[model samples]
Target: RARPGLRVDAMVLSGGGGEREQEEHAALTAFCPGAELRLTVLKLADGRLPAQWEEAKAAVEDLRARTEPDLVLAPRTDDAHQDHRGLAKLMTTAFRDHLVLGYEIAKWDGDLGRPAAYQPLPAHIAEEKVRLLQEHYPSQRHRPWYDREAFLGLARIRGIECHARYAEAFAVTKLTLDLGD
Candidate 1:
């Protein structure tokens, strides 16, 4: 809604096949209506991405072949999850010319850190995001950290950091600023 002509494309490198993949696809659709989503289930064992490094890198290379994204949103390099960390490490290697923003996934591992960038979210948008998460991903509802409060609380903290009511944070390992010379 913010950017009228913006084209959004999401690529999921690690996924379980069948029903779980379908559920994730549906959730992504609900979260970003009209966005293009591609799921490549490498079928790597959970928390073992480091062991399946070749396959992970291959999947990312394939995505790079298909899309030349201007900006890429990927898991933070320092994320606790092995799958997330593996994918994050590959993002810059594959999308060398694009700006890749490493996003955080709040989870039980407590890997949240001081992010270098922030995207301010209005109250309405923040609330809607939490509602969508609750409504679309039923499987995750059981997790203690999957409730509205957890989401909103993190948003609130990030908001304070960025001087906004609510916000999303990202870790940027490198950035090039273009101030017209």
Candidate 2:
């Protein structure tokens, strides 16, 4: 039986802002330690992605041309933050042929769009993930919920969907299934 998820060949992160990408990078490493994780960085002016969508689109396309990943995970199209929303839309346009997964960063306004592909992290992995986030991203530590609880909490809630102990949510911007008859 084949698993549904794509074998992530290379991951292209939009930027290092908001600790979201950093967390994703961390999770990707822990979750898929054996796979190669490639990065494409676009450091746009913070909080100014909507107007600069083209720059992101171009950068990511160039990345796709180079890495040729089976799957491309980006931000959610509908999100509390404009950057997240903008990047999601741009990635959707760019990676039409690849499986694009959207990641969730908990916000006060709620996860604007429902996620499709959820990675259920084990309890210990979730805790260790929080620790890695705190240790590496020192700049975000003072910020609220950038700590252990929020990350672990989100995972716990997602775990409820399948009675798992902990988990992380991701949205699949595009996916295809082959149901054999």
Candidate 3:
């Protein structure tokens, strides 16, 4: 709604083409009805992305060959999850010209860190986000941190930083500003 004609192309690199992947597709569809979503699972074993580095790199390289995204949302390089860290490293190399924002995933590893950028969300949108997370991803319901409180708490803290009711934060390793003369 913010950008009426915003074009979104999402690539799921580590998905295993299982129930979880299906749920992810459904969630994305529910969240952004018109966005284009591409799922190209490398079929690598979960949590073993580092071990399959070559394959992962190849898959990302293929994605870069096909599309040139204006902005890329990737995992943080310092993320504790091997898969996220591997992909984060690749994003820097693959989309060197694009503005790549590293997104943090709340996990048991407790790797959340200070972010350099934030996008404020309205109360209705924030509440809807929590609802979608719970409703679409039934597979994640078992995790203790996968509840409403955890999601809302983080959003509230981020919102306080940006003076909004709710917000999402991103870690930016590099930025090039153009101050037109």
Question: What lDDT tens digits, residue by residue, belong to model 1 across residues 32-77?
Answer: 6755566555566667878889988887888889887889999998
The global Cα lDDT (0 to 1) of model 2 is 0.68
Per-prediction tally of clashes: 0, 1, 0
- Kindly report which residue stretches of model 1 are placed more than 4 angstroms away from their true locations once superposed: 36-41
Where is model 2 more than 4 Å wrong at Cα?
A: 1-37
- Indicate which candidate wins on TM-score: 3
Tens digits of per-residue lDDT for model 2 on 92-145?
Answer: 887787787888876666664556667777677788778776766665667675
Model 3 Cα lDDT, one tens digit per residue, 1-181: 5555566666666566688678777887788766666656557787888788898899889888988888999998888888898899998899988899999788887789999999999988899999999999898899978999999999999999999989999998888999999
lDDT of every predicted structure (CA atoms): 0.83, 0.68, 0.85
Alpha carbon deviation, residue 134, candidate 2 (Å): 1.3
Q: Whole-model lDDT for model 3 versus the true structure?
A: 0.85
How far residue 51's Cα lies from its native spot in candidate 1, in Å, is: 1.8
- Give the candidates in order of TM-score, highest first: 3, 1, 2
Clashing pairs in 3: none
What's the lDDT of the predicted structure labeled candidate 1? Answer: 0.83
